[model samples]
Target chain A: MTYTAWILLTASLVGLSCGIIGVFLILRRMAMMADAISHTVLLGIVTAYLITRELSGVHMLVGAIIAGLLTAVLVQWFHSRGVQQDASIGVVFTTLFAIGVILIATQVGNVHLDVQHALMGEITFLPWNTIHLPVIGDIPKATLMLIVVFLVVLAFIIAFYKEWKITTFDAGLAASLGIPVVLMHYVFMTLVSITTVASFDAVGAIMVVAMLITPAAAAYLWTDRLSVMLVLSGAFGVISAIGGYYLAVWIDTSISGSMAFSTGILFLVSFIFSPNHGLMSRVVKPYTTTE
Target chain B: MSVLAVRDLSASYHKNKVLYDVDFEINQGSLTGIVGPNGAGKSTLLKVMLDLHPKLSGSVVFFGKNLSQTKTRIGYVPQRGSVDWDFPTNALDVVLMGLYGKIGWFKWPSKKDKALAMASLEKMGMADYANRQISQLSGGQQQRVFLARALVQDADLYFMDEPLVGVDAATESAIMETLKQLKENGKTVMVVHHDLLTVEEYFDHVMLLNKTIVKHGRTDETFTKENVQATYGGALRWMKEA
Candidate 1:
């Protein structure tokens, strides 16, 4: 496969995984929490690097997941202590992300990690960091990690489909039915953390937030069924990845930024033109009415 | 047989006590109405019994066992407005959630589960709205859909939080009819109700509450004007004149 193909594949896989989890976040009205987790994960990455004296992908992922879970726990604790939901998220993520930024700025100088790569990402250079495998010979390490994360997320959703559905829709009901709703919630947050950490190097925090929310939001506008919405969001994510790759190549811009931009565009299209709930359909309904 | 027993139950939210040493026993195969004023902790009582709220001091037992041990025999219908109606789901899908516990982990809803959901929808007069998105349904229809979900549970004990609020007259009658059928099937139901006029008509038993149980017995014996005045306090004068 060409280098560009590998990059596009990595982008698509990231989108697919992020998109699936994004639907649940949107449904639970925690899309901003995704943004919060992605930002706070930088703290985890830097802390791991500081401790291990290495910048391996596995170490960074572990660090980021821990940081993400901490963010969720702190937010919940604040909310329980009478702080508002958005306020708790805002306070936690900003403080942690600020610490992460300061650490990278002052301590990680001369290392391969830098502020620019942390913020904007370096998807173009992903193919250069290849890992040799038994059968595939060599593949980008990001692609392999993303594939594993994607499979894990897929298995989780399938295994706990009903639990997630009931919990997202009505947590009180889920609890009354003995579904262990709180445990399911933590498990879900852990998956979201994993997805955010895996997408760190490829899409960066900004695009991770974008992919984790926009496509799912777009799918929401198109369908009133959770199953269909999940499928549509996955499709929208892959389409945006492919479309964004070409658009980036054409315009000579950041691939992740272009992909995130495409997701926003797709969401706008759905907002305007969705069959049942779109603005256009509502506006045209009165004129089309014959009764 | 007692389906539920609550002893010395007390609960608070943010340091403000809501329920104070509440005690009640609900017998099997009876429809009981929990009635009280706006801040009288009627809903809090149900929540406390279900262990959904933090109890300052209490013990709730279900059929001689703890809640966790007897959860499969219990069903819940939350308030109509508590859920997001715009959630991306049809009525049938919401109804199918009743079987999630019975279906257990790592499994999908079987055909039998879907059929039971459909039958429950039909029982609540919501069969026509099975595929309709929940947000598009009328307020009364939405309430019926929730009722159907509870029906599909086939539980021995059901706790419904204001199932009749904001619903149409037909829907109210439909819900009452279903509750009657549940009673006929030897199932126990406790409803948090607001309409004082329908207490005698709807429930065989009534528990008037005001931070505690003021009266609890057969509706004919306990749902008197004095008990209501004690339950509602200043609010009962207007009710009396009406």
Candidate 2:
């Protein structure tokens, strides 16, 4: 496969996984919280690497999950203590992310990760880091990780469609009917952690936020059905990846940055042009039939 | 004969005591109205019994067993404003959520489930609006959808929070008719109601509560003006006559 194909594949998977979970995050008004989880997992990764002095996948995964959940808990704790919820989210992520930056700057000497790499991501060079597995032969390491997370997300959506739907829609009814509301919440946070860390290597910390929320928000304006929203958001993710790849090549710049930019463009277009819920539609309401 | 029983049930929100040592019970085939002032613990009491809120120290028995043991025979219509109406789903889909407990969790809804949901929507006179986005529905329509969702549960006991608030007269009558039908069918329903004028007419049993159970019994016997003044303190003026 061509390097371009591999890059698009990696970026697209990031788009797909982040887009789906991001839908729930957007609907639940947890988009900011999801961003906070993504950034704090950086601290978890840095803490793991600082202690072990080795870039082990398991350590990073464990550290990221812990950090993600910790971020959620601390935010909830502060909110309960009378702090505004968004302010708590901002305070928690910024503090942890700063500590991670300080640790990486002062202590880490041999590690390949830097603050820039953690934030902006380096998707342009992901194609060459290929690993030879027995069954799959040679596949890019980032691509393989992306595939695993994507499948995990897909399987979760498939298996718990009703559970996820009910819980997100109304926790009280879900709880009354004997659904494990707390368990469902934590499990979803764990998925956000895994997806955030998984996309970390490809889209960086910041663009992953863009990838997660932008496509989902755009899709939300178009459809009034959750099922349709999911599918459309996935398609928007692909559009961002493929279009952003071409844009990145044309400008000779950051692929992740271009992809994130494309998401914003898509969202802007949708916000202005969405038939039922867009700005243009409201303006044209008197002239057009809304059926 | 008791459908639900609460003993020494106390619950608090943070440092504030929301419900203090409340105790009550209801028999089968009863439609009980829980009436209280604005800050009264009427909603919290229902929440704690359903285990949606944590009880400080209490025992709540449903159908001679705990809530978990008898969950399938329970239905809840939480407040109409409890969920985001812009949730990208239609009325039929929302109604189908009631059947999830019966659908047995993690299992896809078959055509039978779809038909059940459709029938529930029809019962609420919302069959024409079944496919409409919930966000576009009127306040009364939204309440009807929520009731339809609870109706599909077919539970023996139902707990509805403020079902009449902000609803039109038509929806209010529809909801009252359904509530009466539930009682006629031997289903027990407890509603957190705010209006006091309709107390005697709408309910057979009334539980007047503030932070505690001030009075509880048959409406004619328990819903006296003296009992309501004691429960609401000076916070409530004269209730408006319908």
Highest lDDT against the true fold, candidate: 1
Deviation (Å) of A79 in candidate 1: 0.3
TM-score versus the correct structure, for each prediction: 0.97, 0.97
* lDDT, candidate 1, A23-123, per-residue tens: 99999999989999999889999999999989887898799889989999999999988899999999999999999999999988788887677777879
What's the fnat for candidate 2, on a 0 to 1 scale?
Answer: 0.83
lDDT of 1 by residue, B53-148 (tens): 889997999999999999889999999888899999999999999889999988899899999999999999989999999998999999999999
Candidate 2 C-alpha lDDT tens digits along B146-183:
99999999999999999999999999999999999999
Please list the residue runs of candidate 2 whose C-alpha ends up more than 4 Å from where it truly belongs after superposition: A285-291, B239-242
Instruction: Report the C-alpha displacement of residue B121, candidate 2, in angstroms.
Output: 1.2
Separate DockQ for every predicted complex: 0.85, 0.78
lDDT of 1 at B231: 84
Specify the poorest-scoring 10-residue window by lDDT in model 1 chain A.
A282-291
